[model samples]
Each structure stands twice: as structure tokens, then as C-alpha cells.
Target: MGTEVQCTLCPTECELENHQVGGCKVRINRDGTLYSLVYGKPCAVQVDPIEKKPFYHVLPGAKAFSIATVGCVLGCKFCQNWQISQALPEESEHRDLDPDEVVRGALYYGCQTVTYTYTEPTVFYEYMYDTALLVRKFGLLNSVHTCGYINQEPLRELAPLLNAADVDLKAFTEDFYGRICGGRLKPVLEAIVTLREMGVWLEITNLVIPTLNDDPKEIRDMCRWLVENAGPDTPIHFSRFFPYYKLKNLPPTPIETLNMAQQTAREAGLRYAYIGNIRQSGENTYCPSCGKLLIERIGYFVKQNLLQEGACPYCKSSIAGVWDQT
Candidate 1:
């Protein structure tokens, strides 16, 4: 038997023998050594608005050079990017962009941050790590939109490099996580708390899938937990879910449901709760102190920003976000 090694990058902790691949499909064990198959081979690359990453609070209106490799830690049924997230390295089309090239691309495109997004960045750890070092060295920021399914050591090591993270807190229940996302919920919650503790700017996204995880009580519970653990200043985006992938049978989340979720978050003491995936007033940022409009946005486009040095321009309340790159 060949030597077996355990991949501890995520909570799944896949132990693989020689020539065996991990659950993420991006890491392979070869002759007693583990190798990341997707390093420096991102399948998706784009210059997107920072708000497209749904990072309303982080350098609003700035562009992000986003990149992602093929593979993910979890298999969410409703994943919008399932085409790349669920593909094997050999099955996907990718670019030969190395870490230094990635940083250069961000600079070339005049992006304020380099984002690891579209798929799980955790699976592309080595690539993200190396690129993040260069991104920081070049005076640019690093951000990620992730599922928050990473282990503690790696997360801590990567936290310092990350300027902001938009975590998909898919649902509040372990059953929902297991049934809908093929993962557990505890580690994600732990990761959220750990990120906050490590001083990384954190945000949360919950895609409201009509019957699956849109319970009002559950939303309240999730918001309360965020207030208690991640703090009330943490912005939570309740996104409307449209039928896609394995979840096509379900109807799109009712507008009322998203509204209820936003109300629930505020009632649970969360200060900055926003609705996503639809055009509404919820997309704008308002001062949690004096209820003054801080930033006006329209579909990822910032029309006007009223924040002065990360604070409300009118009331001067310190808004919680990476509003300035410096």
C-alpha cells in the first residue's frame, strides 16, 4: 500500500492514498505527496465591480481583478457557478496566469483589490496564498467570496492577507447545510468567528431559497448569532435565489421573504443588513446611527458615495468596512 496523507485544509479532512484525489477534486496525492492540481491555472478571470463580489462596504465602486480555479470544498445544490466549481482540473478551460502575473493583471486593470471568487478560494490555497503575498506587496488589497469551509490553521495564515471576505452563510441549520450544501455548519460558523477575531473585514450572504432555508425564525437566529459572534457592524446580505442547477424545482424567493429577512436582521441587532440579487433600496448603505444614506448604488454601480473616511458624512458615525484602501 502506498503512503496515505490526510488533507487538513478543510474540515472534511480527506485522507488519500497514492494517486487518489481529495473530495475537492483539485488536490491529488501522488506517491506519498499531496499536490494542488489547480495552482496557477485559474479557469475564470475577470475584472468585476467590487459590488459584484457583493462587497458593499469595501472600496465601493472600485474594480476587482477576480480569479478562480476549478473545484470547491462543498457541493451546493443551488450554486450559480457550478460549471467551474464542480469541474475537475482536466475538464475545465483555464489560463496559465501565475501569481506574479495575477498581481500584474490587477495593476494593469487598475483594480484596487485582487479577488478570489466565482468558486471556493480554499481549494486553490497555494495559488491564492502566493498571489495574495504579491498583491499585498504591490500595495493592492486581497479579497475573497467564499463558503467559509476552511480549517483554522490555514484560515489564520490566510486571514492576514485577506482584506475582506464575503462568506456564504447559506443556512442556519446543520440539516440544511448537510442536505443542501453537502457540508456541515459548525466549521463555517467557527471560521466566521475566527475571521472576525483575526481582524479581517467580514460580510455574510444568505441566498434565500424559498422553502429550504427561508424560515423567519432561522433568519432571526442567524442574525442574532452574527450580532453575538461577528458583531452587529457586520453587513449581512439576504440574496434572492432564482431556480438553478439542482434546485430548479423551487420558485424564486419572494420579494416579501427577502424583506422579512432584512427586517429580521435589524430586529436581531444586526446593524447593516442588505438585500441582494434584486434592485431595491436595500442595496444602499445607510448609517446605522442616524439612518442617513451613506452610499447610493444601482446594480453594482456606485452612483454617489457620501462616506467620509469610512464614516457617515452626515452623522460622522464610523461605518464598519474597508472604505479606503489605506
Candidate 2:
């Protein structure tokens, strides 16, 4: 009988037989040993503004050296990076950059942090883990923009090394997760709470798709849950969803919907809520206590930051975020 290995990294718990790849399309079991096919092989690499990660609460106006491999655990229908996220390891061209090299690239580019983004970082767990260790040693921070689909054990192990995270909360309902994302909602929610408990500076992104998850009640419920579990200080970004990938049948999210979602987050006791993907007053950060503009941002660029040592200069209200690399 051939031996099999179970990948417990994510909730999917894909058990694979010899020579079979797991559901993530990156991990394969060979002779009872499981190996990551995408480790040290990232298909997407670049330097982006930290705001581009939609991380408003972490080192505002800093640059992040971003990297990602070519596979994901959950298949989201409206994935913006589907070209790389849904492709197999062998299907895309990748750079052979090891952990040390990744740290070197970050230093070379003058980045304050190394971000695992553009695709689900959980899919390249080993690579991200190793690089995160080196990133810390080199006096740089580690961040990830993930879908929050990871299991508890792996998330706990990785949390200490992670300085910040932006979890894509997709939607509030299990029906939406199962139908639109081909995954479950419970684990994602659990991961978010776990990230908060682990002392990681956490932000959330909810891509509001029209007619799918734009229901006001559902949005309110999600914001309330986030406030209750992840704390009222956690920043949430209500991003406008554009039709793409397998979800092209749907139109872009209405501007009013994004605004309403942000308003709901605030009403739910979330201190910092912002609208993303479109230019508006929501792109800037204001003091939750005094409502004074703390950071003025134009798209991904920070025009001015009036924070004095992570506090609102106007009202002296301390903001919630990793303001400095130290």
C-alpha cells in the first residue's frame, strides 16, 4: 500500500497519496514525505507602498518588498491576482530567490518591511517562514496580506515573527464563502481572532461585491463580529470589488455600498474603518477620538502624516498601528 501524507497547514487538511499534489496545487506527497513545490520559487516580486497592501494601521507611508508564489488554498471567484494565485507551480515563470536573497532584496530596495502579498502567503508557508526569520534578523519587519484560511497551529507558530497582517475577510456568511470562495467562513474568522490574540497588528479587508455580499445586514454583522472579537481598534478596509476572474458576471461594487460598509464598521464600534480602491475622503486616516485628519493619502501616496510619535497631534489620542519599525 502506498503511503499518504496529510497537509494540516490549512483547514482543508488535504490528504495526498504518493506523487499526488494537495488541493493547494503546491504541496505534493512523495514516498510519504510532503514537500512544497513553490518554496524558494516566487513568481511575483516587487516593491509597493505599504498602503497598496491596504494596511492603514502599520507603518504608514513605508515601502514593502512584496513577494508571492503561484498557488492558493481557496479559489475565490473574484480574485484579482487569479493569473498567479490559481496557477500551478510549473505553469508560471518564477525567480530562484532564497530566504537570504529575499532579505538582501529588501535591504537593497530600502524597504521597511518584507510583505508576502499578491497571492495567498499561506500557500508558500515554508518559504515565508524562513524568509520571515531572516527578515527579523536583518532589522526589517515581516507582513502578509492573506485570506486568513490557515489552521491554528501554523498561524500561532508564524504569528510571533509577523509584525502585521491584512486579512481578506471576503464576507460574513458561510454561504458566501462556500459558494463564492470555495471555502468555509468559520476558519477564516477563527484565524482573524487568533491573529489578534497573538499580538499581531492586524487589519482586515472586505471586498464588497455587489449583489453577492453587499447586503447591509450582513455587512453590519461582520463589522460587529470584528469589533467584538478582533477588538474595536482593528482597522477594516471596505474595498470596492471589480468584476474579474470567474465573477465577471457581476458589476463593480457601487460607491455607496463601500461607503455604507465603512459607516457600518464605525457604527459597530470599529475605531478605524476606511474605503479602498477608489479615491475619496475615506482614503485618509483620521483620529478616531477627535476626527482630525492624521494622515492624508492620495491613492497609495502619503501626502502628509501629522502623527507625532503615533498619536493624533490635534487631540493627543493614541492611534492603533505599528507606526515605526522599532
Candidate 3:
């Protein structure tokens, strides 16, 4: 009893004995106290375009100072960043960047947004929470790219400091999540709803893997649910999946499948559905009412943004996004 603690950050509810790490391999129990081992330690750090986070609606083309530590809550067989996400935090190379240093790095790199990405930010919750607070002092916005496999309390606590988020929907069925992701679907869905309730700008990313979760009907159901629960304007990115990690036996997701998902989303009342991983017209943001081009993107780079003060120039339709940081 003196040397055991439970991690309530996520649905996993990992209970650990003294010196034992949780499922995330980041949070550890030490003498009846929980400690985050990856706090102030980042394995990856860089300046990336905000679009790379697939947050098309938030600060388009703005540079984001991105950082991530190793370890993830889910065991996605096809995780692109499994090299880090699957490893123990100390097993990877990391930098000694504290909250203040993280803020300074973003400012030094001319990035107005700080993104906790490349791996699940929830695993490193303490670090991200502290960094978000420090970054706010200097007028920098904070964003998270996550799996959304977190409990409501921690997510609610973190929401006030967050400006935007991109949650990976992964798939629509509990079976797919259990078999392919080693997780549950319901918690992720709840996380999405909670983020929206907190008034956080939310976007979704669904990687359409061939024959796995690429069924058009399921995609439509997911879209319809978003439209009903999260709203029609929630931007959804249908990302193309490439073979990686344990799922390399499967071929990459076909272009046609991504197109089908995108079409399904629009038809299901989603106003801003996009295709990713392949370059084409789906990358651009068009006005839902006027069908006029609002933000033209060419493979993660903004070609032209025609929005005049966050409204469509032709019809003056209000675009839903965080256009201004101030």
C-alpha cells in the first residue's frame, strides 16, 4: 500500500508498484508517488509547418515549434513513428529542454505556435502542461497532435492552455481498435467530445488503410457522427496509409480509397474534408457555400489564402478556425 499508485491519465488505469512504469513507459510510481520520467526531456524537436500537424484550419502555414518524447499509450501496429512511440524514453536520444527552454526555442525559431506532436502528448502530460503555461507568457499558442486516448479530467485540465488539436480517429469500430491498435474506441470518442466541449478548435485525421478501416460505409458513419456531435465544420483529414512497422505486409492505401472517404465526408454534411499523403485538389480549402477557393494548399504549403479577415471574400461566409493568435 505504501509503494503503489494508479495512473488515472488514461482509460488504461495502469497501477504500478514502486519503481514500476505504467503502460506508457513514461509515468512511473516511486515510493507511492507518481513521477513523469520524460518531464523536460524531448527526443524530437523541430520547426514544422502547422499544416504538417494536419490542422488545416488553425494558423495555416504558420511555423510550429514541434517537440515530442518517446512512448505511446496505444500499440498501433502501423504507427509511422513507432521507432520512438514504441521505445522507452531513456532508450532514445533526448535533449535537456525544460519548460522555459521550450518556450525560448519556439520564440527563437520564429514559431508562434508550440506543438506537442510526433508522438502521443498525453504520455508526457506533465511536460506538455508546464510548457503550454510557459509558452503562453510570451504570446505563443499551444497545440497537441494526439491519439486522444486520455481520461476526461486530465484532458479538461489541459484544454484551457490549448488553442487547437488534431485527434487521430484511427477507425470507427471497437473491433478494429482492439485488434489493430490494442485500445478501445469509446474513450477516444469521448475525448473528442470533451475537447469540443472545452471550446478547443478540433480537427480529425483518419488514415485509410487498405481493407482494414477503408470501408466507405464506416467512413460515412464516422462523418455523420462528427457532424451530429462535433458539428459539420469540423475538418477531417483522410490520410493515406503506407506500410510500416508490424503492418508492412499490407499495401499502401489507394488514392481511390482516400477520394471515397473525402467524398463520403462531404456528402455526410462535413464542410471541410481533406485528403492527405497524396498531392491533389483535396488539399485545398474551399468555401462550402460559394464553392470558392478559400485556402489553396500545395502539399502542406499554402499556395494562396483568399480569406479576408476570416470570411470568404466572395460570400462572406465565416470560416471556422483560429485565424488570429491575438
Candidate 4:
């Protein structure tokens, strides 16, 4: 079998012929045409907190109607959602929720956003892009929790409708991304730059796995790069790695690591840094201009909201996030 057809969604650019799939198991070449088997097909759907997306910056505390299709473009060894993220279209249980149905569900669930999450939306491009167009007209924001792994053309086209996106900057080193994620680091960086340049509200998540991608120097480098490329105001969530999927033998990331990561980010010039999947005291979201808690969160619950007209009510300093016009 000669590999000839090209897939430009990521840097992989897997060339393939009929009966062949790209580096991602989901995209296939059938009789000379590339098609996504997951299109218009959803395997999981629910309403979750925008905070759960670790998007503490956008619509904080609002419920977001979330959807995910089976199959992932990049196969990560420590995938937390591998059950849904790594499966064939025919392998997972699904709901026939079309774009129209998705809009209805968001409104029904009293959600202000529809999140294409739990898997890489880039692989299911048509399904997500079309759904985003429809949902925006109904006053619903389109949010994506993505790996930032896509070609510039598709990313530019989709950036307009996106109200917010939480992109994962997996690691700073190419070796980590190449070996673990089955992806390249450069395209992900490019996509993040393009998103910020396109004026899309953005957040970044870095899942620190022990002995894999968690070098203090690497984390510092990642944070520095984020501040330089995506802007210092971009919210960065340093999520604690829980052993799952193929990483069952590794112990969960310690609380100290998450805190240290957040501190490193702050020291590196990130204005808003957070630690996820851990319970304990954390100094999250203080006014960059004046030290005051703008939005205090502990374990996914918003304990205090100190914003008045999107600015800190205490010291009248401007906060860097979208606040409801309440």
C-alpha cells in the first residue's frame, strides 16, 4: 500500500491511500476521499461547569453543555479520558446529537456555552465547526478544550466563532510531544499564536505527569513561552496528573508539584495561574494591579466573586476576564 493522500490537519501530514488512516486512527482515506467517521456523531454529551474545563477566565461558574466524539488524533500514553478520547467511531456508545440538537440541549440545560471537549475537536473538524456556527446565533458561546493541534488554515477559519478556548501546551520539548502524544510541538505553538493573534479568548492547560513532562526547568520554559507568545494575561491551568489509561503504575502528582508549577508560572509573568484536580489551600486569581481575590475558587466551587462591572470591586483594579453583566 503506497501512502499518497495528504492529511494537513497537523504537522504529521500523514500521506495515505485507500483503506489507510492518518497518524490519528480516526481520519481515513476511502476510495481517494478523506473523511471523518466521527462527524455528526457524538459519543458523549453533558452539561459541565466552565470551571471543569479549567476555564476560570471565561463565564466563570456558568454551566456549559459539553459534547465529545470518539477517536483522537494524538495518542497520549497518560490520557485521562482515553475511554472516549481513544476509540474508533464504531467502538463507542453514541448519541445521534446533530448540531441543531446540540443548540437545543444547551438552552434546555440553561448553559451559556457549548464545549467541544473530552477529545480533540480538530479531528472532528466538520462536526465542531458547523456546530459552533449554529450555537453562536442562539447567544451561546463556543468553547473548545483542545490540544492546539491543527493546520493554520482550518484553525483560522474556526477562530472567528470561538468565544474562548483552553488549549493544552502538552510540553516544551519536542521529544515529549513526539514520543508520548504522537504529535509535534511546533504546530501546537503555532496554533496558540494564531489563536491569540485572531483575538480569541484563550487559556492554557499543562498536565504535569511525573517523570514524563514534569521537569521544573521545562515547566518554566513552557510558562515563559506562553507569556511571550499568547500574552501574560492568558490563564494557565497546571493540572495535576492522575494515573489513568496507560499510566496506571505512576502515582498521582503531588499537591506540592501543582503549587510549585503555579508559582513558577506566576514568576514567569503569567497573570492568572491555577492548579487543578487537587484539594488544599491555593492562592488563585488575585488582582494583578492590586492584591485582592477577584474570583476565589476551591475545588471547582466559586466561593467569592469580587468583580463589579468586570473590575475588582475592592481596589477598582481591572480583572482580565469576562464577567457577567449582573
Candidate 5:
């Protein structure tokens, strides 16, 4: 049982008894002490653009030190990074970086933020939480890219260190979540709502796989739910899905599907919807008020920025997102 200690990290409030692991396979219960085994031991680390995290809203055009550890709570059939996402701590190699060392490394690399990414950061909850706290102490912000499978108690406990989050709503239907992902949909939705309520800058990513979770009606429904819960101005990235890992028989998501998804979200009242992983000019940011090109991006690199102190330079309308240039 995950009941020996309190664990509401990401919807999986796996209370541990003595000498057991939670559903995520990283957190451990050792003789009544619940310890996150992956703490201070990052299995992976890299430096990347902030937009690569697909967080176009948080500190755009900045560098973020991205890190992750092995293990994941949800067992999705089509996981792109299953080698690490499904591997145990021993199964994957790790760097000898501690939480404090992580902060120092980000600073050394000229990164403005530390991102808990690559794999499910929630599975490595202890590592991410400790590192986030230490990273924030150095004045660098902490962000997370997660599937939003967290419990309320643990999320609140870690909120002080959390700044921004890119949570995947995954799919709208519980059937997709249960039959395909071996998880429930309610908790993911709850985590999104909780993150918003906790004042975390929230962005959403929905991977539209062909014949799986790509029903246009369902996508529209999901967008409506986001607009209702996360607000219309919230940025939602309709990511392109490729045939990878276990779902290789299917071809990559068509560009047209991505465009349609974007239009669907915008029609549903999401003002900042985007189509990701495609090198289209439409990827550039436009002023929501005046349709002026605000920030131009080519792939992950920023080409031109027209924001004057966080407001659109053309219309002077207040844009959403944090861009303090710190």
C-alpha cells in the first residue's frame, strides 16, 4: 500500500506502508519513512530553449536547464520516451548532480530557469521538489512539464517552489485515459484546476494522435473545457504526434490536422492556441488585439520580438505571460 506516509504529489496520493514503492516506482517507503529515491539523482539533464518546453508564454526566448529522472506514473502505450519513462532507477543511467549542484549548473550555463522536464517530473517528485527549492534560492525560476497526475496535498506542499507549469491534458475522454494510458482522467483535470488555483502560470499541450485521441469533436470539447477552467487567454499547444515507440504503424500527424486543431481551439475561445512541431510561419505570435506580429520565431529560436515591456508595441494591449527579462 502507498499508505505508510502521505503522498499527494500528482493526483496519485499513494500512501505507502513500510517497505514499498508507490505507483510511480520512484518514491519508496522504507520502514515507515517515505523517501523519494530519485532525490538529488537526475537521470537526465540538458540545456534547451524555453519554447522547446513548449512554454511560449513563460519568459519567452530564454534558456532553461532541463532535467529529469527515470520512472512514470502513467503507462501510456504510445510513450515517445519509453526507454526512460518506463525504466526503473537502476535501468537508466544518471548524473551525480544533487539538488544544489543542479542550481549551480543552471547558473553556470547562463540559464534563467530550471525546468523539470524530459520525463514525468512528478515521478521523480523528491528530486524535482528539492531542486526546485534550491534553484529558486538562487533567484532562478522553477518550472515543470508534467502530465498533471498529482494529488492536491503534495501539489500545495510544493507550490511555494513552483512558478510555471506545462501540463498535458492528454485526452478528454476517460476511455482514452483508462484503455490507452492505464490512468484516470478526473485527476489530471483536477491537477490542472488546482495548478491554476494555486496561481501557477499554466500552459496546456494536447498531442493529437491519429485514430486514438484525434476526434475533432473531442478536441473541440477539450478546448471548451480548457477555456472554461483555465480561462480563454490560456495558451494551448496542439502538438503534432509522430508515429513513435509502440504506435509506429500510424503515420505522423498531418499538418492539416494540427491546423484544424488550432482553429478548433481558437473557435472555442482560446485566444493563444498554437500548432507545435511544425515549421510554419503561423507559429509566430500575433497580437491578440490588433493581429500585429509580436514575436517571430523560427523553430525554437526567437527571430524578432516586438513586445515593449510586456505589452504589444503596436496596439499597446496587455499580453498574457511573464517576460521580466530577468
Candidate 6:
């Protein structure tokens, strides 16, 4: 192994030798040049409710045409979508769809948004970037479901085209990130700040695993950081972790733990904190000012919306989200 070339996309900054792929598995060094193997070859494509992205604040009940290629930068042990995220291009079933075709597919499906989801979109950067441009040109919104492991410069370039994003914060500690996810915490936190600063409608998901990252104090600290950096209005979803992938040995996150984490977020000055995976009243959106329910969601479907345009009817408090113009 000689003649190393570094990938500046994420903090991993994987330096690849000849014929070596980066940590993502999709980006490889071929004869000293870096190339993305899974470009335009999306393995998963489906139309889903925008709420399913758990982007509760953006385009409420709109349908999003979601697409994903193989590979991811982070290898979280409890990843539910590990089949696609951990697989290489050749290891997954994929279909050929260029940027233009992806835009067309969204229109054909009567979707208001195009989402890069199911797997980490950052590893399929080239494809997502190109498709995002076309998606904007077609007047369709662009969104991403990601792990938030990315560099600032690339995120800056990608931000303008993005209308919404649901980032998986995963955990609060560097110890948990390194030991459990094969990644770090700082870069993800940096990326979240970058996204928020860019005016992208952002939401965060933290998979609460029992006996791991379920500490209420640690969650409160995480919530405080988000409130300080991303704003108190930023929606935080503390998702339940099922036994999956490499972490199948661990028990699922308890409902009480998820509730405690949500309570911790609210106590830490967060305006919106939600519980996910298993349904409860926390799935709906309410006004932080008057305690009036603004949007009532039944699972992934919006059952009722009581907002007058974008603000709560009772209190007229401005909800921090892209509620209209989908």
C-alpha cells in the first residue's frame, strides 16, 4: 500500500492506497484517482409520506419520492437499514436512474419532494448533488435522511438545494460514537450546525438504546447543545432502538427511557421533542407557547392540522418550520 490520497468528505478523511476504497465502500482509489462506484445506481426507490422521513416540520402530509444507493460513511451497530448502508454497489440490487430520471420519477409519482433516504446520502454525494439540482429546476423540493457525518464545504454546496433534512444524531458521547458507531461525534455536530445555519429545515433523530445512550443526564446535555447550536425550535426525535444488525444482542429501548429523554429535552429548553419507533402522543406537534396542538399526526399520516397558515390558531405563535409552499 503506497501513494495515499485522502477523502476530505467526512472526518474519517480516509486515506486510500492504490485500489483501496474509502471507509464508505463506494468511493475507491483507482490508479490514484478517486471514483464513486454507486453513482446513479439507486438500490431503493419508493414514495413515502414526508412524515415517514420524520420530517414533521416540513411539508407535513406531502408525499416524497425517496431514493438511495448502497453505502454509508458511518457503520452504526444498531442500523435498521444496514443491508443497503453496509453493502457495496455489487452487493445490492440496483437500478439505473440518472439525475434527470430521478426528477421525472418524482413528478410521475405526484410527489412534492425528492428524498435521498434509506441509506446515507453523503456516500452517494455525486448522485444526490446532481439530482438535487434537477429537483430544484423542476420545482420539486429536495430532502435528505442522513447520519450527518460530513464536511462543511460539501455541506455548504449542497445546502441551497436542500429544503429539508432529518439527521440521525445517534448519541451524545464520543465514547458511544467510537465504540458503537465506528465514527466520531464532533463532525456530526458540526454538520448539524452547518445545516441549521444554511436555513435548511432540520430535524434530529436519536436512536435511544438501553444501557447505552439512554442516560437522562447525557440526553439533557445533548438537548442543551442542540438548543444552543441548532435552536430550541429544532425538532428532536428520540427514536426507540430495536435489536438489529451487529447490536442484536442488546435489548430494545424502553418506552419510559424514550419518554424520559423527551422530557429531558423539553426541560433543557427545547421547544419540540418527540418519541418515535413506538407510537404515543409525542408524535404530534404542538405550540410551545400555548400548549395547543398545531398538527395532529396519526403515525405517519397527518390526521388534522389546526395551524392558520403556519402559526397556531389559538396563540398565533410562529412555528419554526417550512409549513407551507410544498
Candidate 4 TM-score, C-alpha based = 0.95
Question: What does candidate 1's lDDT look like per residue over 169-249, in tens digits?
Answer: 999999999998999999999999999999999999999999899999999999999999999999999999988889999
Write down the lDDT that model 4 would get.
0.86
- Please write out the lDDT profile of model 2 over residues 210-242, one tens digit for every residue: 999999999899989998899999999999888
**139-187 per-residue lDDT for model 5 (tens digits):** 9998999998877777777776888999988899999999988888999
List clashing residue pairs in candidate 1. Answer: none
True-vs-predicted CA distance for residue 153, candidate 2, Å = 0.9
Tens-digit lDDT track of model 3 for 113-161: 9999999999999999999999888999999999999999999999999
What would the per-residue lDDT of candidate 6 be over residues 1-326, giving only the tens digit for each residue?
Answer: 45678998877899898889998989998877889998889999899999888898887899999999989999888889999889978777899999999988999999999999998999999999999999998888999999999988899999999999899998899999999999999999999999999999899999899899988889989999999999999999988899999988998887888889988999999999998888789899989999988889888999998887789899888888887754
Task: Tell me the whole-model lDDT of each prediction, alpha carbons only.
Answer: 0.94, 0.93, 0.94, 0.86, 0.85, 0.91
- Runs in model 6 deviating more than 4 A are 1-3
Q: How many steric clashes between backbone atoms does each model show?
A: 0, 0, 0, 0, 11, 0
Instruction: Put down candidate 4 lDDT per residue, 59-143, tens digits, no spaces.
Output: 7788989998987778999999998888877677888888999999899989999999998888888999999999988888999
User: Distance (Å) between predicted and true CA of 4, model 3?
Assistant: 1.5
Give the range of the ten consecutive residues with the poorest summed lDDT in model 4: 317-326
Structure candidate 2, residue pairs in collision: none
Error of 4 at 322 (Å): 2.4
Per-candidate Cα RMSD to the true structure, in Å, reads 0.8, 0.7, 0.8, 1.9, 2.0, 1.3
Clashing pairs in 4: none
